[model samples]
Target: MKMRFLAHFVALILFPCWFVSVRAEEIKSPQPCDFKALFNFGDSNSDTGCMASAFYPEILPYGETFFHEPVGRASDGRLIIDFIAQHLGFPFLSAYIDSIGTSYRHGANFAAGSSTIMRQNRTVFQGGTPFTFEIQVAQFNQFKNRTAKFFNQEKENSFTKDIPRPEDYAKAIYTFDIGQNDIAAVISQSGMEYSHAVISEIVDNFTSQVQYLHELGARTFWIHNTGPIGCLPVAMPVHNAKNQSLVAGYLDLNGCVNYQNDMAREFNKKLKNTVVKLRSHYPDASLIYVDMFSAKYELISNANKEGFVDPSKICCGYHENGHHVYCSNRAIINGKEIVPGSCDDPSKYISWDGVHYTEAANYWIANRIVNGSFSDPPLSIAQSCHA
Candidate 1:
């Protein structure tokens, strides 16, 4: 009887120690999951409706696939940013320009279609005025100031009211998907010879913009690099002659123009290096570089595996010779109103409107981004937001 009691006592003594160790480990590996907001900045890739609100004003065929009506998205469906917001358990972010009745409690999107990193007056494909990176940052600063004052007023009016604290800004995620338009502008206006210098300027401007945000109390950044522009149906027709002779030898296995993809790769490399430097410079910040190129490339390379019938062809665009002839909302043909057409099966096509990805492709990429293995430092959107 005495020996039995002693054995029980020994186990009791060790059990407390074991439990304490396990709990300490859990405490050390704190998985944060209470992110309250998401602030986004970028170009058409992430623009929900800023451009549409400003210029197009809910044009048809823009958001026909997903929203069933035009909601300002550049694609036939949702953009990658929309999926990210949905994955993070937040409603679609409202554009800063269209925040009249919207709640900013979950943050706002300052991105616009054709926005460039540099502070230049650039027109996007449809001649829409772009809100450059500088302009976006300025808008963000304005938002912060305005929100802070409003919160302060609310707190003063009612101490019992649950108001968002200033520290919440630090916990919010700031995402960027700009720089593509900048590269595209350079390629179209200045040719490939000046691309290196333009890309350098782009990186420098991007770094500066990040620094500005960091100064404004943003600690978490999710920056996306430029994607394969040359592969887009819009780009293929424009740059085909530049490398027509080498097309047979240089095109990707998926049939995308290699020269444009090469340019995208170079930009990604430099952006990656720039992100590394930013990490070192701001050791306390969570600066993540999202590899959008690889994500899109994977979808293109494994289209069949992903249940996509055509990765290169656009789901909604002008048709010519059994291929996409670029995307446009309307074209005047013989004085009649002819609109851009859509494929019967968008779910089976990767490209949407020749430039953006279909809703299916965006969902897949967003799933990969938030589920892990697509971001640098290897953190998913869920983990990043929660952290």
Candidate 2:
């Protein structure tokens, strides 16, 4: 009986992996299309080369897994933004601080790691300049400015005198992935009441930001849904209790934190509905909402069931209370020079630190997006190449 039970358990474990691999193999690769450039906005999950350099050198350890050094990513390696750009056959968009002579003929990255949808959310998240959605619009204007100069230089050399208008100079693929920080910061800084208010109030602010971008000639939009917040390790200590953690509120029939998980669901539902309404609001706008929430849950929930050993704990964190303290300094621990600890193979783990995913996890989510699994009505970026 015991041997048969073990055999059944092993088969159950192996089946999901085989299933996911087969599904991955079945996905059609992206074909090159008509988008001249790609522009990214929002927080760290999509930030490729904007956050780490602008903030702190200690950010190195965070990207050590895949990048080997700080490449201005929030995770330990490539982010979803990089994957999307690569899928489109464009070079990784240069950071504003990089001063590299890259072809902006495509677009530029305006994403900053701790950015928010609302300007006020910055103060709530602690340090750094508030690269609000409004500011991202301004950065797009700068990109348009640079593209105009490139065209004007070409015109100066030719006989043609037709100047490209701002609209003509702008041909882009725009992505917005903000708002989680705004929701998170509300709880981190203000009371829960403020968090609830932010949940309701930011809908209009988000709509306005999208509308503003549309007015600026941004037509191809990839709006990402909010990622799972209750699952983050940082929240573990914050929501800890004697009997259980707030994360317990997301469990299925297993006495887990279903209620907390539902909070994330509620947020995604509203955002999804808003996307539907926004599509109706602007007939010319081709806005696609990407549901990262469900996909993130797919990777995170039962992480142990998916080959990760430690789901509740971070790779590097304070051992006492399960809190994250910067593990930057290579100090002596019991006479050995140690920077505390880091995950052996970050690719195997879904999370890098307490709050974010490993590069491999980001790749998985991007693969899901590219495969049209994350999109409503399944609109792949490859399909929008003609847009």
Which candidate achieves the best lDDT against the true structure?
1
TM accuracy, model 2: 0.78
Q: Model 1 Cα displacement at 87 (Å)?
A: 1.6
Off by over 4 Å in 2: 1-33, 100-103, 121-128, 153-170, 189-191, 237-260, 302-305, 327-338, 385-387
Assess each prediction's global lDDT (C-alpha) against the native: 0.77, 0.68
Highest TM-score against the true fold, candidate: 1
lDDT of 1 at 167: 68
Every model's TM-score:
0.84, 0.78
Query: lDDT tens digits, residues 1-387, model 2?
Result: 999999878877978788678778898555644776777888777666665556564456767876687777767788888888889898777765545443444567888777777776445556545677778778777766655674555445332232234444235678878877766765555445565565666666788878878877888788888887767766654324445434433455422244455556666787788889888887776778888888877777656776775555556544334323544545444575556566677777776776777787788788888766878757787665332
Q: Candidate 1: how large is its RMSD? A: 6.2
lDDT of 2 at 175: 81
> What local lDDT score does residue 120 receive in model 2, on the 0 to 100 scale?
61
